[model samples]
Every structure is written in structure tokens, then in C-alpha cells.
Target: MNKTERLLAIVMELQRSKLQTADELAEVLGVSVRTIYRDMMALSEAGVPIIGETGLGYSLMEGYFLPPISFTVDEAVSLLLGTEFIEKRFDPTFRKSARSSRRKIEAILSRPIREETDRIQGSIRLLQKDEMVLMMREKVNLGIIREAMTEDKKLRFTYHKRVAEADGNRVTVRTVSPYGLAHDEQNGWLLLASCDLREDIRHFRVSRMSDLTVTEDTFQTPDNFDLQAYRPKDTRSTQVCAIFNPEIADKVEEANSYYMETAESKEDGYHVTFRVREPEELLSWILGWGADVVVTEPESFINRVREEIGKMKEHY
Candidate 1:
């Protein structure tokens, strides 16, 4: 960091914490002790109210604070766009706060910067399905899940599975400790929680949740659990290979099936490999392709496809 930036950061660090030792400051700021000493001298010479004890540490005097930091046009634009995204993607509770924050940020910008920020922000569009327009049940579940996570409480809900059993039963009740929430383009909102019934961490799509309620019971989150880095293990190991007609190869790739591991185009056709929990998971997808795709490996899977085709022929 530049000297000016480092000076500002030192002031910020002091304001954030109490009695920061030179060693602690050096380690946190990634500078040497000698550099920290020099910086301390520089800060004191600049008339900053920093009190340093020989044995203890350094601290800013009570009631001392830095003035409001100014933002560049680019910074203002970035923050305004972030607030816009939050306003669209979050529930009503946070959407209102985002609007307020956007106004406050715009209010502080200078006339030229504000005009430039508005021009830039107007040119950029963050297009996505608004979360507020989602199903009422899903929106309610999202709010309850957020509150449960904030209060460190448990949540009880009925979840509808994506896949149904032979008996057509797809509903199950679950009580989970809401750990965190995530969103993706495909899935609107996913709740990562520790499931009581499954006795493990599980992801529940908010859209599939029904009758969600927060419980009064509170619990502490485990230190080892990191929401940002969490990914569910893919246990699908069965490899199924296929070849699609070159005419529809691009279309096949566009499908972007979760289990598609590899796709290669050769002289004859487009070779594709899929690893799935079970071969049956790809049965419908394969049938949808009709004669455009052919299975090339796992003789049993080919036979299963033949059997399905025979049944389909009989129906015809």
C-alpha cells in the first residue's frame, strides 16, 4: 500500500480495535516492526491523537475519529449498483434498506461525481428475476429463514422433493438449524442447514419449502463451518457414455446437465460422458433425444434403453 493509504488504514484499524500493539499492527497490515515505528512517528507528527505506552500498546484518544472519506466516481457507481442489486434480489425488509442506502450515498457525492455515477449506473443493467416476485410461500420462507439464521434459532418446515417415489410421495417434514443462505441463477434461494432427521448438513431450496416456522431454540454455529466455501459432495460415480448426432451436438451442450462430465466431437458424432448417482436419472433425458443420441458404454444401460424404447413402441 502507498504511504497515504497506509496512514488512513492505520487510523481505521485503531478506530476499529482497542490498544493495538505495534507488532499486532505490523502483522495485520503486513509491514515490518521498523516500518510500523516509522509510521507511528509519521502519524504523531501529523497531529493525530495516538497515545502509545512503552509496555502496552497504541490507541487513539477518546472521541477521536477520521472525517468522512470521499469516494471516486467509480467507487460511487459500484456502490450504487450494489445497492440496486440488493434492492432487487432481497426481500422487502432489505430492499427498503438498500433504497435508503442508495439515496444516502448519492446525497454525499459531488455534483459532477453524482452526474457521472448516474450516467454509468443508468447504462448498466442487472437483470434477474426479482425475489419479491417469487411465490408468496417462498418469499415468506426466505424471510423466516433469514430471521432464524440471524437469531441462531432452529427452523421447521415441510420440504417437497424434486424427485418423487413410486408411491408418488415427495413430502417430508424437517427441523434444521439454519446455518446460512445462498442464491444462484438456477435456484433462487438455498438454505444450508444442519438437518435433525438427516443428521448432516443439507441444502433446502426455498421454493420447495412449505409451512416454514422459526423455533425459539437457539444454538451457536460451529467455528469450522464456513458458508462461503461450502459445497456438497457429489457421490455420483457411475459413468455413462453416449454419442450424440453432430447435428444436435450444440443443443446437447446447451442443456448443461449437472452430471455431464465430458463432451468431445469426433468424425462420427459428439461423444459425451456423464457420471450420475444412478443410470435411471438420465433415462428421461436420453429418451427426449430420440434417435439423435446413442449410448456407447455400459451394456446394461443400453439394454435398459432398448427395453424402454420397446415399451414406447408398444404404446405407439
Candidate 2:
């Protein structure tokens, strides 16, 4: 590692432990006592909390924290996997942040930890197409939205939304407080905000927003504004069953925790059941699975699928 990397790593190691003697730090870092003193001075100059006494070595202050670190084997693997996923699956700005975070992590670890991160990164397979153009645009939009969210500022924008029919002209809306940003499988980016005129939780497509401006007028977020409540929940109380081919079963099982109890091994495939809140959401998921899954129950859902197929055929 370079000098800067070594210094950063030393600081991280020292921060993780209680007060250590200069001798201890020097021994761990494989450097002489004089070199340790030099490093300590450099750290202190860099605004690092390296307090020490004549006999006692040094310790980081309580409030002092490193950017973020992964020490455990599992944690290292998880970080690598999560970073890889973000880089592959998220829009451009998110991917850049993920890469930057990963670099910061690697700069602080020892050789062994670095090797572990490398191994995990190399072994993990994120099977998704890289949407570079979308990623880049989304990254810029996300940054602006995130800043506005943190500053608790009102936003002004010309938002376009379909009125009555899918082919209808877009309606322009002037909105206010943006509560949060959420991801929709079919919709891409959805901005959860309170419409100034309607005064309700309204979802707006981020891609459709134009002439966006962050206003100085700040607004209060609802105390009861729970993201969990806003998120799509299982609407169907009745159990709906489906059979998943082996290829898709493994992927589906890994993606959702609720399936653990419902998945059963069949002679040729895996049988699964779950409560679905929206048939549309479930249908989208089923379509993504292609021929790997078969819907077996809830005749209404099956009928809805047929109706959708008819509509699709009409379009074709």
C-alpha cells in the first residue's frame, strides 16, 4: 500500500481498538517507534483523534468514526456482493457511490481483508444488463432529490402524468414537499410527495418531472409517514399457489424471504404459494419468470392474466 493508504489503515485499526501503546501500534504496523510518532503527528495534523499519554499509546475519541468498514468474513462478502449489485443494477450515480465506498473500505483493510474483498468480488455473479445511459441520468436526478430530501426543502416542478387513458395527454402538476424516493418495478423512479393542492400522499414519476427547483419554503414531514405502510403489501389474504421450475426456483427463493415457508419440492419442480397485494405486481413478476413458473390458484388472478394477454394481443 502507498503511504496514504497505510496511514489510513493504521488509523482505522487504532480506532477499532482501545488505547494502545506506541510500541503496540508500531509492532502491529511493522514500523519503528520514531516512524509511529511521525505517523501519529501526521494523523493529528489531518484532524484524526489520536489522543495519548507518556505511557499510554493512543485511542480514537468516542465520536470519531471511520467512513465504514467490514471486518468479519461474512461482512466483507456482504459488502462486496451489495456493491456489485448496486454497480450492476442501479442507475449511474448510485453505481459511482458504490464504487467510491468500496475503495474507501479497501484503503483501510489489511492485506488479508483486501484479498477477501477481492475474492468475494470475483466470485459473486450479478446477472443484470448494465443500463449505462439510464444509470448516468438517474444518478444526477437522484443526487438532486437526495439533497432536497436532506435539506427538508419544498420542490417546484412541472410533472407530467397520464390523465384518463394511457394515450391521454400528460397533466402538469406543481408539487411541494418530497417525502422520499422509491423504486417501482414497472415505473422505474417514483417520488413520494404531498401534492400542494390535494394534500395527500401522491406518487410522481421522477423521469417525467421537468423544470425541477428546490424551494426555500420548508415543510414538515408527517410523523406517521411510514415507508413500510406506503410500500406495496400483500393484498390477497387468500393463498395463491404457483409452481416454479428448478432454474427459477433458486433465484426466486433467494430474492424473497416470505417464500421459505411456502416453497415445496415437487417431482419435477418447486411448488410455491404466497399472498399477493396487487395482481399487477404479481403478474409482472410471473412474466419475468417466463416459462419457469405456472400460476395454479386464484382463478381471478388467472382470469386477470388472460384479460391482460387479450389487451396485449390487441396492441400487437
Give the winner by TM-score: 1
Tens-place lDDT per residue, model 1, 105-202, is 76456556767887988899987754455636455677788899889999999999766544666899999999998987667788899999889999
Model 1 lDDT on a 0 to 1 scale = 0.84
Model 2: residue 10 alpha-carbon error in angstroms: 9.6
Residues 1-316, model 2: lDDT tens digits: 6679768867776654557787876776678888888888999999997887777668887666665544776776687678876776555677777975665565455556667767867876756434664544454566677778889998888776533323454566576798988876656677888888666667777767777788898988989888757863333555677888877677988767332338888887888887643444466666677677778878888787778678877998
Q: What's the TM-score of every candidate structure?
A: 0.66, 0.50
C-alpha local distance difference test of each model: 0.84, 0.70
Clashing residue pairs found in predicted model 2? 91-135, 92-135, 235-277
lDDT of 1 at 153: 95
Query: What is candidate 2's CA lDDT for residue 189?
Result: 72
